[model samples]
Target: MNRLLLYVHFNKEDSLSTHVIFQLQALRTIYSKIILISNSHLDRVSLDKLPYDIFLQRNNKGFDFAAWADGMRMVGFDELKEFDSVTIMNDTTFGPIFDFASVVDRMDSSESDFWGITNNRAHSADIGGQLRPLKEHIQSYFITFQQRVVAHLSFQYFWENVQSYDDVNQVILNYETAVTNYFIQEGFKYGVQFDTVSEDISNMQNSDFSIFGVKKLLEYRIPFVKIKAFIHNAEKPEINTIFDEIVSSSDYPSHLIVDHMTFADYPDRDYLLSQKTLDFSSLKGSRTRVGIHLHISCEDEIESFLSSFDQYLDNYDLYLTTSLEEVVASFDKKVKEVILVDRGINAILAWQKIQDRLVGYQIAGHFEESSFSDAIDSLLKPAKKIVAYATINEKIGLVVSDLTVSTRTEPIDEDSMWPYMAQLWNMIYPHNEKNLKKQDIYVRSATASFWYRPKALEKILSIDLNALVIQDLSAMATITHSFSNLLTYVAWANGFDFRFSQPHLLTGFEVRRRFESRPFLMVEEPAILQLKSSKAKRIIGYTIKRLKTIVKKLKY
Candidate 1:
């Protein structure tokens, strides 16, 4: 017969109180003698309800449970000396199923002093003297011992040497380690039951254990306990119930219906509004008069994007048509005048108001009301060209007759402005024919456009415009030839003595021609240009020297 002694040390907060009771009840039917030792009064009362014998620790102030249990084990071992073996189980351990009796019988028959049920074990080098490499450290302190050793040696002898709880734990660990090493050294065949019928019983309280493992343990009819000491600190049930309700309600589809005309993807709204405000602010005016009829069905995009712009372009006057609060707030203290048009209002009535008040170019994208006809009509009334940037495909049939339409495409080169020019040419003539001679539209390189604009403001704006122009031309020869003609025309008109040729001279004539042409469309003073030129030369020389040094190092 194998008598099992179960011991557990826990506080009020241990999570395994209830789990231990169920395990004890299940084990009582299987094991001949089941003894439980615990420090908790609640646990004792719970155990008393069951058929198993319970030993309650009276003095709970110190870590004396190990000593108390060890003494009890000695007494029990002496009484059960005739018994084949003694099994010690922690409260957290569950089990002793399938052929556990056979295993004990085998261990009793063997000459080896100790038999470990679990394959998992650990040995510390410093404490164990000679260490036995273990597959894994046993999770809970549980062991089966031969009754003769327990009766003769006594657990009291082991406990007497242990001064503290830490010492007791270390002794237990070292004992197992020494036993494993000693068995290997003595050439003794000690049995290790790899296939055990029991599991760590307090796993219900151990949330870290896999659910699959718990299910497996339960399936094998193994007795187990679940301890939950954290239940006292649980949040009020009402609060949890209310929170769950709110989460479920929010996830309900009926609660989240969005109007196709009103809803905009958050990012799209943000991007559009950012681009709109940035484009408006970049216009050359302190009190920039801007008319934006955001008639597109992207209310969310319009709302967020415009909200971001409201922070910066406060000085500019804006006319907007939207019911969104952010659009309304954007008018606060920033714009000279704000006209908020209700989205629900009549479209024709809104268009009339927009057309009458919008004197300059109207800023819009893909609007039915603000069409090419409307833009051309506005341009005919002495307004500057409708400077609108549109997507390459979207710009088709959007003929802004007199207005210069700035169309943009995805970037294709290091030069950021090329794509814009490429798309613009595509918009002007929606054909993909590559006949250089037959094409009426002439393309110039950004480098060449830089040399065309002369005036300061014209030069500054032309830098971007010229870059866009040159971006359309794929070949350098076409750009270079076209730039020469454009520069010659400008020189003749401006009364400057300048001409450009192949293998160009960087003399006074070339310099004069470059300045007159405003290559790169820069409008800096003569002194600034001279300084920049000298600095550029120095940078080039430095870069060349560094490249040579790197080459030399690479060669070595």
Candidate 2:
């Protein structure tokens, strides 16, 4: 069949990810034509000669629904019936775990007009009053429509009539849930390639067992597996071992999955990588330009900082904001651009000046010398602003203990000079009082080290930092002279909220103090995980229960 595939893609970093590339490559064989609808704020020139037609857009309203609507409009009414079939796909899932062509061919031969690989009832309490899942709809990650269904008036109406929504629940109710029902109610049959519903495949009480069902999806020719599946079982003990086996067996690239989890939710990654099951050598993501801004005020800390930085200095441009020629000469080849600001220039000026020089980069980060070097990636995450956990120094006294790894937000002194300073902060041109109020307005920590998106900090950049207060804050002329403590608030006040970086576990210089093992009973490998089937496990557990009951009865 001559099929047209419309893909909705959103890369928070505005670069094509390895998984998306893999998905597109797989689709090339299945579809006659492909078009990508992206909400990435990227230039067409930078995208180069990506094989498919691309529509780069700015409106990020309805998530996948918005992108789908935009793609349909771009395809236009005349092009609607040009293909034998149409498929709506997105990058939320991680694979074409197996080849997609066989699945497409199978679906094409079937009488079903609209179908997806798997269908699931949401686990949101059913009419029975028991915890039964309801609403079996084809998961929207990959949905295909035969020409008969695609040509229907309802299909066109669904796209054209899509509405904007602030809350995601509205998007699901209208775009995903309601759209599927509309087609089914209008004399159209909907089907799923996998006969098993979500609840049926694995009991709701133990959804982690759904991993086995997903394995069938791989063997039964299901192309895509949702990435969120792993997230749901991230805390499960065997999740790492199971996923490693799955990735290796499926022939899906390992780095794509691991790299995504690292940023998507690094805590999950810590477990997955602790065992080092996945190979990360082939994990080169799409070419992205990220500039970093760093200050060099302390002579003692520079050497220590560079030593830590040299560990992951991979091809990234380092921007230093220091006027000291001695400090610049002290630096090696790693320093790319040194924007010379006077030694007395406050932290705000250094950042502002550096940002002016970092135009066109997708991600820009700022770090203090003491901030862990590994915090670079954590900082560059596609949030409005991201701050490293200031574990020691600066806010060290406020943290209360040396063992504390995260920076905490505390209430500022209301009656003191801070209220006047806050007044001045709100008066900063282009400020957003509404967004600032949404966050902790009187946050006292986390101004020492952080990363922020330059676009989100535009208001901060536009202002002359030196003029914000009377003179450079380094002089500490007044009690409010410590404006550097409020930089986190500046980012927030400018409508750019910040998220905390994963707490760095250990220091570069410190050895992990080893201690004697605590008193505990030793167990064999069964405690980690059992390789037995559910039936076998249940039988063992039931036998144990019966034996205990008999022992109690005899004692009585």
Candidate 3:
């Protein structure tokens, strides 16, 4: 009896993705018979050069199911039943990402007759056996079948009845969801790498080894991770920091990941080449694919801000006080797009001019010339209608969960000119019963720059900017600060909500339940946390000196 692995690989670009190539190296470890089933329209000459057995098929648009079924057809049922165990896998993920062989080795000895790498309760269909079970549906990315289960009459018929569909939902309903339900009805008990379905998601039990759990990152406990999860806040520093730490401790090449990302462009010349020539032209992967357009109100220190981002992309549609213009020749692989407001008018007006232009983009943000590269990453990670600020401050309240805490980073008094501005702010948002608290509404920073979907600001932008006049103030707080401070409120007034960029640094919700007197740590960027957590104290001495007061006040 032997073990076999059938890998289903496809891409719309007519070539295998770099992520697939990385998975192949690990596949060789556990499978006695390794086969690749490709539906991508790749060059035959290049495909013929691959080391493993290959089955090229027509692109039926059924997702992974079509590839797997066609590949199994190549390996007749007689041959499939001969193997002691079988695993059906696909290129939809980026692992046995960490020692996948070990995961297979453990499952080889598992008590259950069949099992999947993990299970998820999400995306329930609720139609009884027709849909996935309420408790769990063994995830289909990589599932193993013992010989006893493989030889079952039902197993063969499952594939015989399997269908392919152009509609994505129909495909999932037919294959991914159908397989798990079929298995459970056949009286087979299943297990998962991470049992988070029963455990609390916040705590790292067994280091939380599911494919997508952020906690499992500490141990690389789970072998495969769905590559698409990296798009949002799923790429948390707290999670990836553990993975990077593991990589740093090992002899493995970090460039493998760096290179895999570069080759992710798909349809590259070296798609099937065993030996890839790294692009020496750029020391790092290009940031062209990872991007967000920055709309800066005409502010000084623009050069300083440009230097802080990963790439200095000058691509923008500039809007002047009188008209709009595009900055040409600024477009390159490094930039997605850039928009500039030439007139040194107020920030809100600049945001208004570009509101319509930003309709199509899913993620975009507003920035003062005051953000760092790391802050940009944090801002872009959350789901839609998200208002992620650069950092959290405690000037508002002791509890982190309390959203109505004071945002006053500075003081205002009866005689202060800001007090008069507060009166004006009250006049604008005034409803005698639900009056906007002048203090809690203002953010910790005097500046109001945030990242959110462009459409969220449509209601606020509709207000006539021309009717408003900025009166010069003798006080330190001016009209600019008052207008900028309304950002959070504007978001709340709309249907959006926000989370602080670094909740781990402050009193976590669990900790906030207790009345501890630790001063709130008000950090402005993710880079500051890196510096604060640095083992090399001397490296961040200057930054440390400036932050001591902020950190000390919180602890005392």
Whole-model lDDT values for every prediction: 0.35, 0.56, 0.49
In terms of lDDT, which candidate is strongest? 2
Best by TM-score: 2
1-556 in candidate 2: lDDT tens per residue? 7998888778776766567777787788888888777777655663453446655465677788878777878888558677888888887888777777887898888888888777655445322344433355676777888888878887887788887676776666666656667788888887877766544543334332224455555556566667776677565534555565565467877667765664454322323332221112322332344567788776666666655445544335678777678777667455777666776665556776677776555445566654444344343331122211221111211110111222322333233445545545665643443323222123332434544456655654565545644453543333333344444455544333333333333242221221122211123445325333543443344333323323333443
Tell how far residue 529 is off in model 2, in angstroms. Answer: 23
Candidate 3, which segments miss by more than 4 Å at Cα? 45-49, 122-135, 202-212, 217-220, 234-246, 249-253, 259-556
Candidates arranged by lDDT, highest first? 2, 3, 1
> After superposition on all CA atoms, how large is the RMSD of candidate 3?
15.2
Clashing pairs counted in every model:
23, 0, 12
Q: Could you tell me which residue pairs clash in candidate 2?
A: none
| lDDT, residue 218, candidate 3 | 32
Is candidate 1 or 2 superior in TM-score?
2
Q: Model 1: residues >4 Å from true position, as ranges? A: 2-6, 9-11, 14-16, 58-77, 94-112, 121-140, 151-156, 166-189, 195-556
All candidates: TM-score: 0.30, 0.50, 0.46
* Model 1, residue 86: C-alpha shift (Å): 1.5
